[model samples]
Target: MPTPVILEDLQAAFPGWCIWRSSAGRLWATRNGRHLSQHEVDHGLCRTIDADDVAQLAEQLKEQETAEQAL
Candidate 1:
């Protein structure tokens, strides 16, 4: 699939996050408005996540979701 389509799907799947591919082709995601607390950060949450491809990005997003739910 094309990058735009992938990005659109990712955006829909993870609405709280802004997803896009950089000019250098690295996929990046950042929270739309929600900020992580210090505890969340200590538990492995990040303000932004980057990956080389969609699968990795999705995995990271899932991990973030899990971490958020755990809190």
Candidate 2:
């Protein structure tokens, strides 16, 4: 898991998502209102990413949501 600071930043950027990491240090994020994993946003794709890339991750997730909605 990342430090509390990183987790907080991710939560703020992705307001309705439960973003965290696994015991093995793999990143995981799931939507709150809907029981959906981050993978669902990207058409069942999920990847482990660096904490420092949270901002880029947030943008990707947002874009995924927009793309899904358009489908």
Candidate 3:
């Protein structure tokens, strides 16, 4: 299957803690896609990222559109 989100991306999505691949091989995020792993957060393995982080990521992605437009 195609990998939608990876470990490093998850960490960036939820900064301030470490994030690694779970044996389950699925995204550590929620069904609603709000936060990362809950259990891990409690254990200090990771933390839930704020919505602002996602917005910044979206802005960064605009670079791709700009580049495509130039091309």
Top-TM-score structure, candidate number:
1
Relative to the unseen true structure, what is the C-alpha lDDT of residue 64 in candidate 3, on a scale of 0 to 100? 28
Q: What clash count goes with each model? A: 0, 0, 0
TM-score of each: 0.88, 0.51, 0.26
Q: Which residue ranges in model 1 land beyond 4 Å of their true spot?
A: 1-5
| lDDT per residue (tens digit) for residues 1-71 in model 1 | 32333777888888999998899999999999988889999998889999999888988898899988888
**Sort order, TM-score high to low:** 1, 2, 3
lDDT of each: 0.86, 0.57, 0.37
Per-candidate Cα RMSD to the true structure, in Å, reads 3.5, 6.4, 14.1
Better of 1 and 2 by lDDT: 1
Determine which window of 10 residues in candidate 2 has minimal summed lDDT.
44-53
Off by over 4 Å in 3: 1-52
Q: What is the C-alpha lDDT profile of model 2 across 8-71, one tens digit per residue? A: 7767766766777677766666666565466564574333323335555666566545655765
Misplaced by over 4 Å in model 2 are: 1-5, 35-56, 68-71
Return the candidate ranking by lDDT, descending: 1, 2, 3
Q: On TM-score, who's better, 1 or 3?
A: 1
